[model samples]
Target chain A: MTTSPNSYADKAAEVAARATPERLVVRVRALSDRAIAWLFIAPTIVLLLAINIFPLFWAIYLSFTNFRANRPNAEVKHVGLDNYTRVLNDPDIWVSMQTTAHFVFWTILLQTLIGFALAYLIDRKFRGHAFWTTLILIPMMLSPAVVGNFWRFLYEPQIGLFAYAVSFLTGIPTSEIQMLGSVNLAPWAIIIVDTWMWTPYVMLICLAGLRSIPDYIYEAAEVDRASNWRQFWSITVPMALPFIMLAVLFRGIENFKMFDMVNLLTGGGPGSTTEVASITLKRDAFEAWATGRSSAFAIVLFVAVFGLANIYVKALNRVKQR
Target chain B: MADVTLKGMTKSFGKGGAKRAVDGIDLHIADGEFVVLLGPTGAGKTTTLRLIAGIETPDAGTVSIGGRPMAGLAPASRDVAFVFQQYSLYPHLTVYENLAFPLRSPARRMDAATIDARVREVAKMVRIDHKLESRSTRLSGGEMQRVAIGRALVRRPSIYLMDEPLSSLDAKLRGELRLELKRIQKDLGATLLYVTHDQIEAMTMADRIGILAEGRLVQIGTPREIYADPANLHVAARLGQPHINLLPAGLLPGVEMPPGTKTIGARTEHIAIAREEGGNARIDWIEHLGDQNHLHIKLGEQKLVTLADPDMAVAPGDPISLSLKNPLYFGRDGQRLV
Candidate 1:
């Protein structure tokens, strides 16, 4: 499957084919199953191109020119990489980039560790494992906006159970608990919520990986004089690592572009401490009406996440192929 | 080396309709003996082997290795090695790492150099030293199986528990590995309990073969005893190559059975075929094996096969005479009576 065939085509053949006459389709009915299958899927292909792909190239085109959608009567002017230079050079943009990286790093770290541990515990098949696993997954099933606002209320420091519990456990007064008010705690607060919601996503994947291992492998290990702890470390972890990495990659890309959760939590407030790259882009495109600069920012973020994820996926494949 | 003793061992599955996967059966394998448990699939051969390795706890009775009770002992603490029927090599690890896994255990705590030497040594013993660096996923099925065998042999446990280790290989490779495994077992002088449904593997490799049926030990003897003097109708039909033809005792003309006898079991090789124009049976077909011919003789309501010389001129529709040199009789309960 890794070896792709030699015929690499264009982005969307739908527009190309659809642009042709209807007679062209009737003439192509004699094609093989693979070709006919593509014809049947052409509608999806066109929809994805018009939505997912067309806008991508349009963003790239807009990134290279000064085009603001708000001022439709004004003439469009070519800017030639100036937007890229400005966005890259701006200090506030750099701060948002750092914020995005910080959020991505901490959320993935906390999610992977907690999720794998949860999966390991659930794999034991205790009396009530299925019920508990479903209960743990409730947070992930809820809408992000709902969860974000609900947690915001829980961090209110006045009558919030979270604030009161932390105060009771840490011996700090609930009045001093201003999770969204402080810059340091704002990032930590969003990270805590994201981990709580998304760790179950990771745990589901890791659980599948854990269950796919044959029971005989453990039997053979035990017969070879391998202790349970040794089997867990050597056999269980390595075999499940590719799945773990896949979970990390998904969580990483999602957290990098995270918006609604952070927006609802602090609204990039008190300052821009929690203003991730997507939030900054949203402000520039909608608030400040700087379409070209925001497009350039979006392009840069895309390339960064795409390139890193590509590298991580290649490493995952190698681990799988091992 | 160690001897194994299974005393009244019993195991079962399901709750209400519990099937006794391994019924209560006592067996003793002496020190340095290569004993094969032969049976049809799902006949508790594997379950019995697992019970001995401590992989599955017996519902009743006990398993003792070298005269020590293995009641609550973990499989790791039982001084045993298991070679699974499927390729159980760790796919994430290199062949060397897989072979070195047992030595690297905390209980062993072998140093790096010692582990490396032992792994290489085992790899050489299994004839896989050249492919030591290859990861298991990249290895061919045969190579992966060799790595699995090497992994079990690396620790050099006192007893080896193998569940159809060679059943996954092709016929030629299976024969070669059978010889190699026999040599290795002899060289190590380890007590080995092997489980296999293939009669050829059991016949060729076992010092003594134990035939099991319906989770019970039907018979335990040398290959000749089990083959020539089968315990019942099932064992006779199980271990024979061309199959022992079981016919009603009344079908044979001059064959008179005792009061309890109801069936006659005759091996194909024992019956000789002679072409006679007025014989009792007519030849239905002739299977021309290179060295011998198996003639299908139909007599009245029964059909049986008899061996003939390859040079014998025989064809379908030729009247044939059957000479049952010696056929064993079985009672209504399917137990052999002769």
Candidate 2:
């Protein structure tokens, strides 16, 4: 038999043609991974836009309009910078802002400090550590509304257990003291309730951080001639700082937007003295039907939280990079 | 520097003390001597090192450094530095900061300028001076190990304890670092106690090697003495590459002795193999190593390996003669008979 040169070339070209399509298909399959990844991420992006971005832009728009909820048919006339100026100059708004700052600063401070201390104590793995941790976490797990209502009863003047116990312990009269009614005591009451509710959350985060450290580190530090206090400062604190900062960021944001506990416990109480921004915004929009002004207030609160949270996220990223 | 001594040292774990992790180990290292504790896993080498480092208090023994009792003195007070196998450099700190940590430690109490100078000096000694500004996470395995050593060395502690510091590196790096470690220990004249299961490391780097087995000190000697005259069959087996071959041998009634072949112990390289030609038996297999070939020859009922030249051609199932040259005879209980 004789083989033609042209026929062999034709066969080789036919083989190449056959392999090219399959190779192209493989190439297309490999390229589709990026598309699949984008497809998986798209839903989260859409949800974030719907929940956070859309409401933010809408609030900003409403803040510049005179669209009061009581007058629905009234024209949404543009009032450039007027509501912002009013909110900035308003004495009541400033008071609520001060109250918010006070709550956020004190609550975060106390929560972080107490939570870290408790975490360090529990990390020692003594007897009944798990039991004690679970007990501490009960306050964090309780519904804020229920806790507020329960605390209100406990703070009752004569009949409540807390008041009676305090009076019994200190030998002071419990008949006239009103925890949620007095302006001086109401902020402290809110701060106390907030710290009680969130300290356990911080403790849990710090505990995870502490437990993630290997025992060899302490052994090495011991071998390095590091004292107990030195190890705690250099090794333990630096290692747990990221988790502690995370707790602070979470508690700070939550306290800044704190409404449920304040609403349930004091209802922004006695003569606007305990009215936080959230309570004031609620009164403006729902009680007085001033949606435009409330939207402006809401926008301001959103900016404050967003800016602070962004800074905190940057700090967290820095820690993780380290 | 302190001469560390452990007398009747025993440590046990578990609630009822039923489990003995380290059982009755007695060891002493002279000041500025580099000693290596060699053992397999679960052999209590690390426990022994930790005991000497004061990380763990012995239940039965008293540990002393420089003739002072170390019963209640904390690890820091004992003036010992430990380098862990994991290289426990602070991940958040730079190489310089990690090296400076031990120097600035309150227990050490060096001033700021002194700490900086010592850190830089140790960093240079470890050949990681350029990496001083670099974060530890960015460092390679060898670099990290060097930094760990630098951290331990910066304080000039009385005793240096290293727990498998080179175990994580590759074979070539381990060999290179072993030499470096020996040179550094010799140059600094620091009392070093190193722990590793790698016999080669113990053999090459240790001034005096201590062999441990099952939480017990099996043997301790210089590398030459340990290799030449092992106290037991286990030490004989553990000290060699392919391990010393154990074969039952009976003394022939009036065999003439060969002069200058009276070394105690079976050296595999001394055994010879040739075609049987009406002699011992046959070759079972041939394992061709790169430089030399090992001929597994069956003599009577026992098989013994004989080193052959790489150029020598030998195949399996071939008839072969075996001759044991200067074989150390052991009795039924695995003890060498004179």
Candidate 3:
């Protein structure tokens, strides 16, 4: 049968009319959504480029030049890795590196152990858990400089409470003892003070991680008839590993470039025994006016920290994915 | 398998009687029997399970496994396996390791070969053998749940305590796992104390169901007994689908029904409806379900829902005859009149 032309044309028109408005609206909506998304993201991108990327490139460029702050108007000489060679070969630089490693390792280990214990104790949810947590967090909230000064006073041999307490407890003669004046005791002193100040920070993070775990897990562990030690090892520790690593990373980076606490407490004293890399870098750039060498040293320190932090972040991501 | 008995189990939160989470509860679960605890939220089903698992100690009770008092005994000393609702598999461990954990636990003290064999066997039973190497966090919800079941199964404890293990899964998965759980329980022949708020799960899975409200066991019976003869209005309302029709008998005028049947409850399918104008009722609406239709009828200010065949033609305002079959009657105090 042959169809009428007008009827066929009318059917085609009907189909076209039904499809046009919805399609146009959808296209307009999609374009507007894209525009709105870009509008929201533009400021963040610009700020990141200005504050983070540009400065990183500037620092990289500055590392290769013999640029001294005192001789600002002088021509910036291209040193061609001379500063890096000097930093890598210097015995004092190696000493500082060793000191930094010692400080980071001891402080992070002590802080993690102490912090996890405190978090576990407080996670039991007693009558005054909130109050205790707030009290524990006070040291972390205080300025590092203030804590350094306070601990410096406390470490004084004659008038310090710690010295008197130690002498009373151990019957060690305190008359000739000087805590911050000795090479052997100074690094440990700095580590102790740093632990006292920052262990609570680690504890708070650990507490959050611990509390985030559902009680059902512990219940399941119990049902499986896991002993207390087993529960602590398998359930509590593994679940809180990410937080522990996070605490390690924070304390590691902080101790690597530790300046304020060391400067106030020991001033890198006892013949540079307590002088870490950051302190050495500071003395070179500001005190000794070896700005080029110090910049190179700072760059080395930056690369080490960046590499370590990248590895830690990858571990943290893997833990989170699990 | 061993029988579990809770004698005057009472657990309180905070000192000086701040809150009592579980009040004095006395229950006996026989060996190789499946008992389902039904309760509303905060009714202490989970607390009771924890107490039985030795995760929490009762303030004033003796929990016994096989007639031996578990007082002061650690959880490890009490031979009971617990399955949690959230599928508490170690996220860092693989499905194999997760199942092998309890098997290798020092308290359980299975040898390496035995642990390996048990893990393999339970994994096969749960049908998660293929995904044994996969990290538990990567598994789908159903797979993770199966792995959790396998983990519990590997222990071969005397008693099995599950706290709403299938609550988090979707409906289809829940139905499938319910059957699996029942089959596994039967095969293991373990004394299983399961807790769930879903009445259907309790009905389908339990040899006997214990209903709890406000930390007290209100009623305990088999599935047929719970459905056919509910102890109270709460049990009646909570235990049925197309929910049991509740109609006030006093409102029906000139109807000489049973004098003790003040409030009548009947399953929707049990109520009969017809187009004959014998009763004083009018159809309000008709919901055409695929296999059957639900006829919503109004009778003297009460709504009566009736299930009929889909082909039955009924419209709003159509006169209909109504009669309740095997209706349950409740007294004025809300207790069943049975």
Candidate 4:
């Protein structure tokens, strides 16, 4: 019953011992809202810096130098803007740029047209629509590497199904029409495979857009004495324009950096006929071991994609506003 | 403008649950008449409107416009225009484009100048001409509805079908547009088959109102006729603001009613109320609504309402005498007895 410091200290020691360190910490302390949030997100921030931001800054720094990864003992000279100028002035890089532009334009056009047509057909709620929709989406689900390998085999001149079918239809020999070997046909082959794989992706987005249009709008159109074609152009297209544009933007960004399918099918062979920008960057960085030059090429590509996407996004916003 | 006739039209939707949305109902709306289909929610008024517009095919019966059967005809071929309840304005188009959409359709290819001229005329008719260049989302609800009406009117089809066009507006806006719509219908002299759940709209706009209950048209008459005499207890109960007082004829021991009558109906305005000491009812409350007063009165374990003139002074707990004028009588089946 005596109130003494010794007794009080003993009581405090007893209480502290009864609550173990884990229990004490859990029950006695509370972090502030911001501290808790930061604690939860710290790992993500650290990982993002290590994997994404650090490499970006590193590449920007490396683009200004003449450092080759293969030649370690060579002096890392600070050649200001030399890599940028060299990459820009090189005619080979322009060829790749042209290839990329051609690929992006054709692939987008084919995918959008075919994709929107498929979407319109599926929107009819025809017999077995759900089953057909799932089946049509199979192409988009296959891995690009697998698709490329199979398509390359199909393009084989002698024993391939595609060449034989063409030969059978046109009365030409299968050996004479080589899809992968010929320079002119190699580009078409890659474009065809890309359109085949990605058209379903575009169609999926368009299907969602088409489905989202309310039934009442069409009914109103009907009551207004509009023909079916008129309704299609006036109501359906305008309503689904935003979603279609969104799909285009996504496909454009993806196809601009396209590498795997073309690489697997042609390996940028047939005398550099189908070498896209990403393919050239890959060859320079990993094969030639010219890290600084490859980094500059990659920067140019990144800026191009970023700028084009920004422009497309502005158009998308305007469509949505309308 | 043309007459719209529906002969025993019926539509039943059985997808999730079997419900007859519109039973066999016959109606003949004459040329240049504004007829409103009045009912509660889910009473198949909209379905009937859709059937008349050829948007829905009747399971049994046929709709004829201008003496021609609408069987196997598309909505476009039926020569009708429809306005929806939600003001389904095309959100992506300007008001001018929305008004011009119907006119510029390939079927109705009036050249650009004529289309533009008609758009201007209808826009002015709806009083939305000034806001024609604005995007639909930027306009207010009333303006959107006006544009919707303008869209329906641009082509001047043979008949007009409107589905609860004023239900989305606020009360004040609905009143203003209701008046505007009445004026437009008169000026155009166009046949319109309008549908609404609001009785005030039915009373104010329709030259004749048709009452629907459980997918059947029970009665059709002028507004004054429907007001003075509803077809049955259901129509009587649905048509008034405070609601018609429906009483069992045999329950009121002192009130005199026709023999063999099972139900009695009286609107608030038709009921006679007087302040008396020896009274049969006690006032529970008085609600002042500007120029009108609503009296909540208790009568023999039943609560009834009576509308009082604003000048009438009364309060809760006051004794009052209640009488019925032109009391409605119904047999046990709820059909009106003349």
iRMS of each prediction: 0.8, 1.2, 1.4, 1.1
Q: Which candidate's lDDT is highest?
A: 4
What residue pairs clash in candidate 2, if any at all? none
DockQ, candidate no. 1: 0.71
Q: For candidate 4, give the DockQ.
A: 0.61
Task: Write the residue-wise lDDT of candidate 4 on A1-322 in tens digits.
Answer: 6799999999997787677777666544467577788989999999999999999888998999999999989999888999999999999999999999999999999999999999999999999999999999999999999999999889999889999999999999898888989988989999999999999999999999999999999899888777788889888999999989999999999999999999999998799999999999999999999999999999889898999899889988988987
Q: Model 2, range B97-142, lDDT digits (tens) per residue?
A: 8888777766555688888888888888889999899999999999
TM-score of predicted structure 1: 0.93
**Residues A1-322, candidate 3, lDDT per residue (tens digit)?**
7899999999997797677898786666676877889889999989999998887777677778888888889899898899999999999999999999999999999999999999999999999999999999999999988998888788889898888889999899786457898777888999999999999999998998899888878877777767789888888898998988888888888888899999898888889999999889889999987778887888899999999899889989988788
List lDDT for all candidates, in order: 0.88, 0.84, 0.87, 0.90
Model 4 steric clash pairs: A322-B92
Error of 1 at B288 (Å): 2.6
Pairs with steric clashes in candidate 3: none
Chain A TM-scores for all candidates read 0.89, 0.86, 0.85, 0.89
Maximum-TM-score candidate = 1
Per-model TM-score, in order, reads 0.93, 0.88, 0.88, 0.92
Off by over 4 Å in 3: A1-59, A73-76, B7-26, B59-62, B251-258
- Order of quality (TM-score): 1, 4, 3, 2
Per-residue alpha-carbon lDDT of candidate 1 for residues B149-252, written as tens digits (9 for 90 to 100): 88888887778889998888888988889898999888888788999999998898899999998899999998889899998898898887677888887786
Model 2 per-residue lDDT tens digits across residues A1-322:
6889998999997787677878686766676878889889999999999998898888889999988878889889999988888888889999999989998899999998999999999999999999999999999999998999998898788678877887889887887567777778888888988898889999999999999888998888777777789889888998998999988888888888889999998999877767888999999889988777788888888888999899889989999888
How badly does each model clash, as a count of residue pairs? 0, 0, 0, 1
Q: Mind giving the per-residue lDDT tens digits that candidate 4 earns over B1-338?
A: 89988999889998853899999999999999999999989999999988888888888999989999999998889889999988788788899999988887777668999999999999999999999899998999889999999999887888888999989999999999999999999999999999999999999999999999989999999998888887788878878788888888866667666667888887776688899998988899889999898889888888888788989878899998877777888878898887
